[model samples]
Target: MAGVIVDTRGLARSEQNGRGSAEPEAALPDSDRPELGGALEALSGEILKKRSLEISSTSFVTIISIILGVALALLAEKTFPFPRPLVAAQSACMLLLFVCTFYYFLSISIILRWAPSFADCAQPFIITSLEIPPTYFLGRVTGWDACLAILFVFVAAGVGSTVMWSPVSHFGGDRKAQRMLHRIFREVAVIFGTGALSLASIGLAAHFAQAGKMWWGFGSCAVVLATLGALVARMEIQLSRIHAYYGVNRPPFN
Candidate 1:
């Protein structure tokens, strides 16, 4: 039964248009909105640097995952007809994914601790366009619990994806790179964390009851891992686009 109305910057632009200003917000210079973190061009430069450092940290997880996978394959070959080694390899992979997911969850929690809640605040989800009445009384409208469970699962998957490819460690922990990468990760973490919070408050899917909840629980776990693999692929594409924007050059882009 947790929810909020969304009626801030998400709709502020539309309000300006209705007044026949021809979207002046877009035309206004970056200096006009100091609250928006200033100039887009400068922001892009910083974004590039931060994302590069993130990519390097992300690379560590990628390299380690690949090496582990290859080693398992070779071990399986050596074991040949032995089922135990194959089973062990599978278990290890699962353990690695789970550990990474758990770490990602921890990182998110750290951000949430400092980030303000979007629920029951001035920044609620506006629903005037949907005719649902932003001020409608929506207390415990049944099935809310199930919706929350599903949302937690999805958020888990989303955050897990962020870290499945990027493990945080000291491999590239030079003084400046470390500080910059941490800052970049912090920003990404906050955005992702806020999103997760908003979704969790609103909830997802349908209601599950009795023994069915157990089945849904297992399914959610599988979804988290699968989502991580899929997101990693998408992350590569995103990194390529960012690199192209910043001018693709040598690795360790400073």
Candidate 2:
């Protein structure tokens, strides 16, 4: 009887071992599974490559701007035959350009990091500021020629606004359009206010110049102020758009 029981127990142990071996055979080795790990690694590498490319492109643009700015300053110094006092004015304008460019690059870096979507919104303001110093300096040194340049700039601004408006409206949806339209009205009011202020500054500068005020020299100072006001108005509009894009509806007055 003891032999029979022992044989029975041995039979049960053999069956359990056989089942365990069969279960392992049914399950494939982890190495032989789908290449999920390799695919994910490839995807990660692609994303890194794309990010690197974008960074490179942005750096290239900034470098090009810096080079162009230097060339512009050199050409202005060599070509324009102004009086010594006017040279100071020219140098001031160039300095402003350099400052504006540096600020722009800084702003780009900040916006890219903090608010990339708002970067486009801020671009026009930078461009408008860049145009100002040259316009003001040229107007002071060359009189009516500067006004012609300013007029051309205004026309360009109008054209650019028109070109950008439709696309932005379409992309932003109805709610965004409504917000933008409201902001546009506000911007128009700001523009008018800036224009009025500019006209006043022009009159004041003309008065001072005619009075033989050596300190006032020409209308350059007034032009700079007007240009700054114009840029500020443009920036306000851009910031408003950014706010609207982000679904921010804080009070405009705030």
Candidate 3:
């Protein structure tokens, strides 16, 4: 991101070069002189505001995760037993919620550590008019994007869990219907998985780029592409299996 440049040495340089001259001071253009103090104040306010919002969002997620975890635990303590598949689904949801909470906490920490600060706004510097992006862990890809991607996985898992629970399980016993539902569930899972993978890949590239390891970023990109191809093939194979079992025609993948 482009940002303000502060150059304090210009006046000193001019003074040295113009010693003994009639004009003791070099005149600076109005456009060249920016109100850095005011700019710094504005920037500081914005950073503080954003930091508060980030903390609040993470806190909300944490609280919700705790509530849901406790509720699940209580349900498990009931006398009636849950089917193994339903128990597994609920467990997966709980695990994913934990992951989402952890990811948000990590993102918040990174945001706080990198938030900009000015030691002295009055210090001589060249202030440019360019805008600077937030310097979070992922660089160009904001931390919120990655956080949302993780949450997306959690949501997808929660929705998939319905297939194993009551009401929905009524439809799950029919072989053809069950296969259809599974196909839809798998499609949704692949969609969310692909999105998360793409975001993570970009974040990894940004991380490597910031570390000055372009070679590593390139290698990771290749690996990501290979993984994506494999995901596509896996989906195709699943689709073919569903078609074979249901006596439906499989579409050509080319």
Candidate 4:
């Protein structure tokens, strides 16, 4: 999506060469009102807050997915291993699900790493801003954090691929080749992630069969899937509103 990145650098250059020194807001031409700077800064802050919430919500969903997913896998493995075909299917789905979650967090984290730059981009616009150091990472930078994060993403993808074998084989190539696939991670996660839930639901039903209560475990999974569906719907609505607000027309590839 083409967002309205307030080119503060360009705007500052224009303000400097075109209009000589700082003066009262009222003194500037209507086209170059100082108040607009503050307004844009405020909007940027609001957008960042919204993005942070999106990150948190997605993280929470992934956590719940992993926990319930693990439980479902264990239940199925103990009760319905070997000859059952679902053992193979559940294992594959879980692997892909992990891959999607890894990429999802990595995408958000990389975007957040640029937040300090974004804060600097907001600086001059604020009338009474604090002198912030240019090195903010939302909090602090722990030693080995970057290394651990990179390792985490790759490890998840590696294990997931090992399980699924030919899963996502279409997107295997250099970075440039995978650009189109990268853009649609959210869509993939929602669609295939739903598929993952279905596998888990079936596995749950199979597990409860050993106890002669085949449908009991499915009830819990159904609730979990419903909650996840609601979360995805909310995220889609948020994206649609953001695109509408920014007049951003994302091409199919992007």
Candidate 5:
């Protein structure tokens, strides 16, 4: 009768121990699981942040360039006495500069989307040569007729260029068709913007001349400077956005 004694308590204890072991396995932390996709997403976000900062910096530089250019022109005006012919020359120069700046901006925008390779060459040329010098001269030239004529020419160039170079079959497509369009739009904007700015400057200049208020002339110059700065700033911002969208690095920002 003592041969088959069942240890039911010991069997229950063993089963409980097995259950406890399985509970720990189920509760283990999943820290070691791969998150490659999450890491990539975070990396991409960092890149975008950097790019945005870079773009902002480039925009600042462009603003500065505009300021410097305008200042130079104003300084020249105050220091030198321009004759009627010189005034005419200055107006033409201003017109050219306005056209150039416009073309530069339009080109940069197009380059951002289509042809990046040409941007480097075109942008600097537009900024240094086209946008700055003409604006400077325009501010310096004092004749009303000169200013009006320049404005008229700018408007005419804008309209004519746009029509001539539009994506129509009348304008045959060559390799530089896109470039032409860019030039057309930029010139148009510049013509309008510069004309408005010049009118304001002229009014201020006249007020200063009538009142013998030298400061008024300076104020007019300042206005021109500010307008130029704003123009460049706007263009830079546009360029920055383009760079950001394309995920490219612009100079002074990279």
Candidate 6:
């Protein structure tokens, strides 16, 4: 559980008014006293640790984006044109990468800027807020994984294109190369789908388990999971359409 620092003076004033004739300091409950506040400061260290964990997750996204950007740039430098399906895949991947980067950057920014205020809430509120970080961390990891998966798909396409069009190569229109690329794509999709489902199930279970509590923390997890689910679903659809363009069926798990 996280620690919260309430304004003891204000709390005491209110409680005194309700009780009538009691001194403000006397009206203050032992839990709301300055000694308790000191104890809470220790608890707040745990909350700060969670915040740091999320910041580290943001760094993961940044590194992945840089690597993915370089790969895309190198691919762009090539003189050969990509097939329509590959071009579409590239565009979709870049767009989703941008969305994930922006999403994570914004979240971390809010946490850094408003965390002090959030720490001033009650004990239950502070504890409930901690529930969000686990699911949120998973969502960010999924984003990082997605960027890697996109890179893999793009690299495979580039290799397939080079194998088909290279001047010295006699393997032009190579069925084996094309099939290899397709197999890799489908396998990546299956792995991503499995991971996404596991993440969703865990998030949903957390949401329901906390729904009985009187806090908005559970709702926040639900929103995070739902938004993540939507993004992954859209990517899956785009991948499926690419498969269709190449005269292949959708991934078996889909």
Error of 4 at 243 (Å): 3.0
For residue 216, model 1's alpha carbon misses the true position, in angstroms, by 1.7
Model with the higher TM-score, candidate 3 or 5: 5
Ranking by TM-score: 2, 5, 3, 4, 1, 6
Q: How many backbone clashes does candidate 4 have?
A: 0
RMSD of each: 25.9, 12.9, 25.3, 23.7, 15.6, 26.2
**Candidate number with greatest TM-score:** 2
Q: State candidate 2's TM-score.
A: 0.40
For model 3, the superposed segments whose C-alpha errors exceed 4 Å read 1-159, 162-173, 176-210, 213-227, 251-254
Off by over 4 Å in 4: 1-111, 114-213, 250-254
Better of 1 and 5 by TM-score: 5
lDDT of 6 at 42: 46
Error of 6 at 240 (Å): 31
Q: Which lDDT values do the candidates have, in the order given?
A: 0.39, 0.48, 0.44, 0.39, 0.49, 0.42
Candidate 4 CA-lDDT value: 0.39
Off by over 4 Å in 1: 1-208, 246-254
Count of residue pairs whose backbone atoms collide, per candidate? 6, 0, 7, 0, 2, 0
- List, residue by residue over 77-178, the lDDT tens digit for candidate 4: 543435333334323333433444444444333322222344333322220111111011111122112222232333333323322321244234334323
lDDT of each residue in 108-135, candidate 1, tens digit only = 3322222123321211111111111111
Error of 2 at 170 (Å): 7.8
lDDT (Cα, 0-100) at 130 in candidate 6: 26
lDDT of 6 at 194: 47
Candidate 2, residue 111: Cα displacement in angstroms equals 8.5
**What shift in Å separates residue 123 of candidate 5 from its native position after superposition?**
17
